[model samples]
Target: MTVRKVLIFGRFERFWHWSQMVLIIVLMFSGFGLHGFHALLDFELAVALHTYAALALLVLWLFSVFWLFTTETWRHFLPTGRGLWQVLRFYTYGIFRGERHPYRKAFWRKHNPLQALAYLMLKVVLFPLIWITGLLYLFYFLWRDLPHASDLLFAVAVVHTGAAFAILAFVFIHVYMLTTGHSFAEHVAPMMTGFDEVELTPEEEAYLEKDQPAMIR
Candidate 1:
């Protein structure tokens, strides 16, 4: 078996990944403060910071959406459903017995079946819920002219808070999964350097070499 260092992640991908991670961390911190869960920051200060960070995240998401479509990198998140059960079993049971991964990374596909589905849901469902509810909560004043505005705002707040907690849970799981790579730094180093070392079978290597241009583009 031969291991090769491949440029799996591109420059923009690295930038977006790290930037989104930082923004999410800031949002989580400020969000908890606003929820009165802690006193790290004053209520007013926390509100201000949370709003700013959320807006910045929205902007980043917009640019990222455009980039994903233009580069067709969105294909990476498409669910193939193959080996989904095996992947889940590997994580839940097999990994404890030191079994190998059911799915391997490819030049065109970075995410496993479970990862692709989870990330797709995060982007299409969880994120939209939080963003839309946040907007309604933030601009309640403008919608106050409508009937039942107070109730609407309250519901939005409830959903937004719930989504925030869900995202926080996801963050914890994500951090833990980072250590599941070949080494502690194996998964993380690529995000910083845009390259990853992967072992490939002969057929896989041949396919990757032939499809390199399509993968990069």
Candidate 2:
């Protein structure tokens, strides 16, 4: 199979990915401190840092949402029913047997069925849940006049803490999955340079050739 270097990520895509990664790391560290897991930062300082990081994340998300809609790259995240089982089998059994990957990367479709579903869940469900609960926890004083303010605040804190831990686990899993590519550099380098060496099927090659002029612009 001929492998070719193709542009997979764009400049803004790379920027958003790395910036989000950094902000999430900062948020996690300060969140742990605030939760009394360790004394990395003073409680008040941790709260301030976490709030700032969360706000920055929100800004990045807003920009990202606009970019996705404008570029129509959101289609890349739509889950496919065609290869879900094959992808799951490849991960669970085929990979151990040294079988080929069931899914291939392409310019229009970067994610396999499982990846698309996971990312969609993170963006549409987990992210919103954490952000909403975190905001509620932060502004508890504003709702202190409510009859069950104390209980409500406690519930919000619990949800926020739980979601933080869930995000932390996902981060570790994401890092581990990066090494599963052709080489660690093959996957990680594209985020740095916006190109990846990928194998193209005959149909994909023909499609690329037909759209070559548009792709260049």
- Top-lDDT structure, candidate number: 1
Between which residue pairs do clashes occur in model 1? none
lDDT of 2 by residue, 45-99 (tens): 9989999999999999999999999999999999789899999998889988988
- Give a tens-digit lDDT track for model 1, residues 1-217: 4566677788888888899999999999999888889998988889898999999999999999999999999999997778899989999999999988877776567788999988998999889999999988888889998998888888998999999988888888888888884776877888887777666667767766787743321
Please give the TM-score that candidate 2 achieves against the real structure.
0.90
> How many backbone clashes can be found in candidate 1?
0
Give the clash count for each candidate: 0, 0
Model 2 C-alpha lDDT versus the unseen true structure: 0.84
Relative to the unseen true structure, what is the C-alpha lDDT of residue 59 in candidate 2, on a scale of 0 to 100?
94
- Name the runs in model 2 displaced over 4 angstroms: 1-3, 198-217
CA lDDT for candidate 1: 0.85
Which pairs of residues collide in model 2? none
